[model samples]
Target chain A: MSAQIVAFGLLGGLVLYSAWRVATAPLITHAALFLALTLVGVAGFFFMLQAEFLAVVQILVYVGAVMTVIIFAIMLSTPALIRSGERPTLIQQILSPRYGAIPLLVGVAVTLLLLLAYGTVSWDQVPLTFHPSSQFPGGSTAQGTTGLIGEALLTRYIVPFEVVSLLLLAAMVGAIVLAVEGSRGKEDEARD
Target chain B: MTDVPVEAYLVVAVLLFGLGLFTALRRTNAIMILMGIELMLNAVNLNLVAFSRYLPAGLVDGQVFAVFVITLAAAEAAIGLGIVLMLARKRQSVDVSDFTELKG
Candidate 1:
């Protein structure tokens, strides 16, 4: 029990710190790296929460594919697009305190308010532990999380599953068109 | 069985959401802002999965929703990065303030 708490604390702390870095890193590439770290930490949380399948998906999707796409976008774009040397570093941005202060204050305040709100709620009254009797019907065992999820995705939730596939297809075509059109304009510019 | 309270998860989610809001609001760079949006989406996913765990034991709704959220996030990132690419090419700049010619 204590080990679990310690692990959660370590994972949660790493996640929050990495996420903070993602928000404040001056270099766009550095922010992308931090974003990957944050995603990994979230996957850790998913593991601790016992959703092993989701945790793996989190790593495969967010850390693997999404971060790769973000980095590629950063690299392909002109360096001038990423250079923000005029802007102060994170410490200076806070201490010299020009632009982002109000938003930071608002963020902290809202977070505190949310914590307080949840703190007041009665979590103990609700069921907190998984029960054998409550296990999903199709799984051979209660612990077959991946199998259970696959069953749910194909059976009870088939419509949304198909819809998500359609959404992915649309997004793919849209991204290709947009990227190709932009490069074509650059080609025309070069020709002229 | 883990002894951690569900609220611990919620707290993490709130903090992430807050930081994401700060990032989105403060950053002038469009990519940074997009990263912030991703962070916010992640926070929501954490909340959903956390709450889903405590739901009637057999219910995998939360995990299922998390998967869907991941899919949507991927789509969003693709389209958003596409727009960012377009913006970068159009203006030779990626600064959000510079791209505000659309402002009336």
Candidate 2:
């Protein structure tokens, strides 16, 4: 097999494994770390797919910004939540494990089946419109140019773009309210 | 050029989705489940980007939509996690089971 194939195959396996770990692990902090690994693996997949810009963005946004905030929230709000242990609860012993087994098996079985089916697809018949003239950001052509993505976002998806802006504003307001509400309650209790 | 089969991407998406689903449904910790949901969202985004590369369309619709999906997912995550934080500060626990006030 070619190096590209080997690299991509391993990358795919790594990503899936990390994702599975994220789902199964009990500790919130470990889950966060595993999430970072999953994101890194996704970045590798982007590289293998020849979508360089997307790959970098995957790491920068998912791993850097989103994850950092999540972990921070966990640390500040509940350090005990991150404690590593399977609690002796019914949900821990019987429910979650039992419930998780089905999806795990199905996910594995369906993936293999899909691989077999994909092996049968004819590549030459898969229509593509690759042009040598276009410079996809980060020298990748298998996907789209950054310019095209920007243009499409601003022109075609102006509504969603504006919606995202509103959503972010709402989130900021909500976070402030939640964090502040707790402190206010504590002050009221102290006054009593 | 080294070709990538569409099936490979599909398989990845399935696994990611399954993991996300399990985490969301089973995990007691709210943040972990949110992470799982993000994983699933990323899985769908992967499918979009893959098809944008290999599929019949020249419109790059897959990439555009995927970008929008990512943006929206991020916004949702920020808001959702913020609410969780607020709840955590008040309750001192992130366990979903602890929030029993919602049960009718």
Q: Output the number of the TM-score-best candidate.
A: 1
lDDT of 2 by residue, B39-79 (tens): 88888888888777653323456777776676677777777
Compose the digit string of candidate 1's lDDT tens values, residues A1-192.
Answer: 588789989988998999999878877888899989999999999887778899999999998999998888788765764676686666678654434687788788888898888878787776676543224332346555787788889999999999999999999999999989998998999999
Q: Per-residue alpha-carbon lDDT of model 1 for B11-95, expressed as tens digits?
A: 8899999989888878877888889999999999999988777766567889999999999999999999899889888776777
Judged by DockQ cut-offs, is candidate 1 incorrect, acceptable, medium or high?
medium
* lDDT per residue as tens, model 2, A11-67: 888888888778776667877898889889878877665565577778878898889
Residue A2 error, candidate 2, Å: 2.1
lDDT of 1 at B25: 79
Native contacts present in candidate 1, fraction: 0.75
Instruction: Give the Cα error of residue B23 in candidate 2, in Å.
Output: 1.5
In model 1, which regions exceed 4 Å deviation? Answer: A78-87, A95-98, A127-143
